[model samples]
Target chain A: MKIKTFLAFVGPSVLAMVGLIAVPLIGVVYLSFHSSYVKTEIVEVKSSVPLFGGLTKTTVEKVPQPVLDENGEPVKVWEYVGGRNFDTVADPGGLVAAVSKDRSTTEDGQPTSFRQRMDGLYRDVTDIDFWGALEFTLLYAFITTPCILVLGFLLAVLVNSVVQWIRGPLIFATLLPFIITPVVGSLSIYWLFLDNALVASLLEQFGAGKIYFLKDAISIRTLIVLYGVWHVTPFAFVILYAGLQTVPQDALQAAMVDGATYWQRIRYIIIPHLRALFSFIILIHLMDAYRIFEPVLVFGSNLFANSLQYLTYYILNFEDNYYKAAASAILTVIGICILLLPVLRRTYREQKGVA
Target chain B: MAMTRDEKFWEGMRWAGFGATFLFMAFPIFWMILTSFKVARDAYSTKVFFSPTLNNFISIFQDPYNFGPLLFNSVVVSFSTVAVAIPAATCAAYAFSRYQFKGKNALMVSVLSSQFVPPVVVVLPFFILFKNLHLLDTRLALVILNLSFVLPFAVWMIKGFIDALPPDIESAAVVDGCNRFQVLRHITLPLIMPGVVTSAVFGFIQSWNEFLFALILTNQKAVTLTVGLMGLHTDKGILWEHMAAASMLIMIPIFAISFTIREYFISGLTMGAVK
Candidate 1:
């Protein structure tokens, strides 16, 4: 194919991506360094105050008036702030103070030990909004990745080992949690744990105490993690299930002939064959779990736990700070790149080999 | 082959695991569907047996809760995004598959990396741009934004399919005096139609279930079904029954579409990462 034909074929897609994705990403980076606000100016206004019958007094007051455009909408002015937004979001100064304070002594006036100092630093950094969100986001990623992988592998193995007649229905049933909208899926889980809902009522009948599942931070976070596992396990199962098909039966048969137990054969043969897929699932899961937004919203757990994505969104919507949101957005992107660095390097090496 | 006593035990355990897994996975969806048909009181209660009602579904489409427009918006936005993404992706995928060009690997890598970009980062700049252009809360804005993620996915998935094909037919057509476009339309496309449909359904699912972009980019006029779920939160508190009904509206189509393409679902999701 000629270069012209190739260009023509890929032109629209390339253009759309550049215009929407590449350009917007660049704009986010640029906006991170700048601040925008509705331009306002101080102006004097005169008002007549009615006195007792026909008498009136004039008063002059100064007020700030938003500078409006031809369309009567407030005009916005953008000025470079040079990382002020980043400073506000990160609070490095406060972090330093907190660390230094913790390093000095305990409340009993005893000298702080190395372990205590490190603990203090951890607590201090996480108290900051940026670090706090990052901590939970990483926690979600770390916790859910292993759970999804193990459960998904087990599921794949089970589904694979099942009789042919029941496989179709099993796969169809399993795909429901995954195929449902994230919001709806989370909502479904959320409802079950409500005070009067099925799960809660069942627990009540079994003499378990009435626990307000959404009332506390711990339970809410647990629900979020549970939702992640329930939703994503199918993805891992499907991929690993596909990988299972390619596993050589001779290897398994050989192990069986050697008097290997089921666990032993799996540990030696199946896991080794699916090693590449394990990393693949981990890589994708890490990228997705880091975002972790819809569940946070659906669970109404933003107050208790916020992901990096949610932090940026909260700043933009609740705080009405686009500059700060942009700064955090850039930081979120950086965080993902760092999280994905090892997997990406491996993938790059493989691609090079294939090429 | 005869199983040992231990093997029988393991076999029983596997069946038990399968049953447990099936129940754990299916119970939530079953509960949701059941709740959608129940009255508000029954939905709130733990009683499994109750007289079911369709009133929740009817009420969602009526006054105040008027989901009719939101449903319309979701359909239009999802269909429009897929309609635009599929053709462009097909062309790009064909080019990448057949042609060896300069900077091809770099371009492909960029396309692949773009998928990992969190939507919040993408939406920030778009929100500002749309606000400036008065395009916020419009379906056009959504269709355009959805393309950013959808088109790249479509390209990768479609490219995987095209690469898998023998390409002898397309080459033969090209040699027999059919132009590149003619050959692509007549030969290559017909062969890759299944793959293209899978990508289309996958893209549609992405758009239909998209929450953040729909949340941030739209307010009322263009709210998609996923974002429309938030409206179920009333001043009186969340109407659980109505929410279940709304959820049904959001997921039923997705479940149907995905079930149809279940065979290719994994391949589509992995987007050429796996075979």
Candidate 2:
């Protein structure tokens, strides 16, 4: 009887969890292996080049003709077999006929392996643009995390210590960045940083050159980091500020009575008390910062010196290579899991102690 | 006894630090709002102070992509999510708070860990799933997704608040022939109203500001303000004055809702952290 009740209660939560979360993640992993291609209706074999600002067309006699059915319609001309390039076209019969026969061997006449043949049929996943994107994403996350944390902590402390009348407005104001959609926020930042815009103009007036905020590589990266900090700091501030409120006043007073300076009080009384909160915020921020997309997309990915997150978007949207994007996402997820395991374990222990 | 020079100096330093921190935190937002009122040429120019105009505001309203629908979508998603999530979460929170069930700790831990799952990772799958289910490009899709995200948070946060409430009140009600349902509806619900409101506000704001999931899941029919704002950039090359206007319009309601229930948001954060 007890077993029945236990199963009944656990059943829905488990079902919802699997249905909502697990299935989709598994589906993404599955789709990575499959290849999608654009099929052309007509198989026209022609080559063209321009000569002195004029058009030229050439029809090559060596081009392999398409197989036809009884209806005189062309059949499948290309099969994406999987690998480095999608140049190896196979005929319907799977025979090493005209196209393969001629282009199959080098001048030395060494026979190519079936693996090599197949490898030539598809674009290599590793050689795709996803790797550069992955690198940029990691760097972006690493740089933005500490800036948001320290700044947010300082802001949280400031808000918490303010007078009652001003505190409400101040807290709300600090949260404004967070409340605005990242798309809008990124656009706002882009405008503010434009070469002849408010920020650049002010810089130029102070003997600074026309600061191309989003044009060059280093400047773009700096702007992205700044944009990330601007967008996410409010979240960290809100979480830490709440943590501050829960800190036992008695402990703070005792520390003060012990002749501890403000810094000493913060170091001893505050930081230790907020350790769990800090970890929690950091973990959340890490997960968020790693998956950054909208901002990069809005800012224009081409402008960045190195854009990790934008690269992911480009791989997914532009290249349409789900395999590489999926692989990259999986790698990101693994990195996050590895970093978070220790934090999760600690949080688990703390929860257990409290319970 | 008069204060020493050293004490005065320390006090002055603290004040200076406080002032600097406040300015650092508040300036960007103030500037954003200030820029929203600036004309296109002025907004683009390097000048800090200029005559503010209502042209951006006038154009935003007159523009085909009216902010109204997006704002409406945000409200619908936020409120609907809270309405659905709170009741569902209340039930779950009650079961966890009242019952000494097996795997309770594990269940609680799972709920807490769910918060860490990046929305990006789930978005693609959810997009495909929603497409299959015919829920893609609908407000219902966002509401349901928001519920899933908000429900766990609601459950965990409300559980903390409920657990803090003395069990003696419920025990007495039970002794007086009140069934579990009656006790919860009449007794438990009233006592935890503030906590419920807090959870609702958090859920609402979270749903309101949610971008990645909304961006991926919905297109024209159910696009929220966040996604719509993204469209502005993608469609129009980054028009600073227009974007600033759109941003201010979107931020107004979020500011109002968050500040109105400011205490609850603070308490919700602490409850989430401490737990």
* Per-candidate DockQ vs. reference: 0.73, 0.41
lDDT of 2 by residue, A1-355 (tens): 1345434534554556566566656765565444554433445666766666585767744444556768786663333334322111111222323224443564589877767655553223212344345455677788888888898888888777768798777777677777665676776676677768777888888998777776666677788788888888888888888788888999989988988998998998899988888888777777777667776776665544334445544555566555555544555566678767887888778777777
Off by over 4 Å in 2: A1-14, A33-128, A156-166, A245-259, A302-312, A321-324, B1-9, B46-51, B132-135, B234-236
lDDT of 1 at B214: 88
Query: What DockQ score does model 1 reach against the true complex?
Result: 0.73
lDDT of each: 0.88, 0.71
Superposition error at A64 for model 2 (Å): 11
The best candidate in terms of lDDT: 1
Q: Each prediction's Cα RMSD?
A: 2.7, 9.7
Task: Give interface RMSD, every candidate, in order.
Answer: 1.3, 3.1
